[model samples]
Target: MHLYGCPMTRSTRVAWVLEEAGLDYHYTVIDLKSGEGFKPPFINLNPSGKVPALVDGDLILTESAAIGIYIADKVPAAGLIPAVGTSERALHDQWCFFASSELEQPLWLMAKHTFAFPPDQRCPAVLPSAEWEFKRQLKVLAQGLGDKTFILGEQFTVADVLLSHILTWATRGLKMDLGDEKLEAYRQRTQARPALAKAREREAHEAALKAQAQ
Candidate 1:
């Protein structure tokens, strides 16, 4: 298995999941900032020209959430997900969708307007609305979390991975107020995991290697 990624992006989610599953995989660095992702070689793998594309022998998967789920399901013994037909598994998929769509949407919108877009095309007006929407959505997530150690009650499944990672992104990238102490603590707890640390360390190491080569 191989995963292509750029540091400080959604690809970290995939890396984290792979690390948690204790899977051995190749990590390829794609310089998205340098327009490397738009080139034919990488584009051929994911026509969308996105980071966090996974290649597993004959199968190529794009999108960070899909890659994370695939990795988790592939390694069921790691217990990253609930039983196949259980209600917990349904909740797991639900939160993953919520994180990727409801939570991540505004964050990406804010990012696109703030820096992802070319200066002339950026809309400063979008930031306020995006931040507002993010806060509103964050409240729903906080209520969902309640007092559970993880999303589905106790086990640290990929649902927590998906949600926690996006919360981290919102906290660090958008500067939006998470508005709940428990949520913040939850983020801290998930990030403090050894697998997450390894993923981050690997990302930093690969990023540094790329920097030196440049």
Candidate 2:
């Protein structure tokens, strides 16, 4: 398996899952900042010109959450996801959707308004409303999390990966306070996982190599 990613992007989530599952995969840094993502091969892999595209033999997967789910399913023994058709799996799906659609939306919007969009395209006026939306969604997340060690009880599933990743992006990348103890604790605990640490190190190493080659 091979992963095309940029350091500190959504690709980190998939890399974390692969590391957790102890999968052997090659990592390629797609220099999106240099317009490499929009060029030939990378553009062919993902027309959207985004990072975090996975190539496993004949199957090419895009979307970080989908790639994480595929990796988790490939290694069931890792217990990164619940059994299909089970209620636990349904809840896992719920959390994944919640993280991507609800929790992550505001953060992404904030990023766009802050720096992702060109100066003329950015709207600073929307930032306050986006922050409000993020806080509202965060309250919902806290309710859903309740008092579980992981999103699905004691088991650490891909759902936790998605949730924790988004939470980390919110707190660290966006510099927004979690505003709830449970959510903040959850972020710290999940991020401290050895697999995540290894994933971060791997991405950093690959990024450095890419920089030298350039």
Query: Over the stretch 1-214, how does candidate 2's per-residue lDDT look in tens digits?
Result: 9999998899999999999999999999999888899999899999999989999999999999999999999999999999999999999999898989999999999999999888999999999999999999999989988998998889999999999999999888888899999989989999999999999999999999988987
**Candidate 1 positional error at 177, Å:** 2.2
Which candidate achieves the best lDDT against the true structure? 2
Backbone N/Cα/C clashes per model: 0, 0
Local accuracy of candidate 1 as per-residue lDDT tens digits, 33-77: 889899979999998888989999999999888888888999999
Clashing pairs in 2: none
lDDT of 1: 0.89
Q: Which stretches of candidate 1 lie over 4 Å from their true place?
A: none
True-structure lDDT of candidate 2: 0.94
lDDT measured at residue 29 in model 1 versus the true structure, 0 to 100: 93
lDDT of candidates 1 onward, in order: 0.89, 0.94
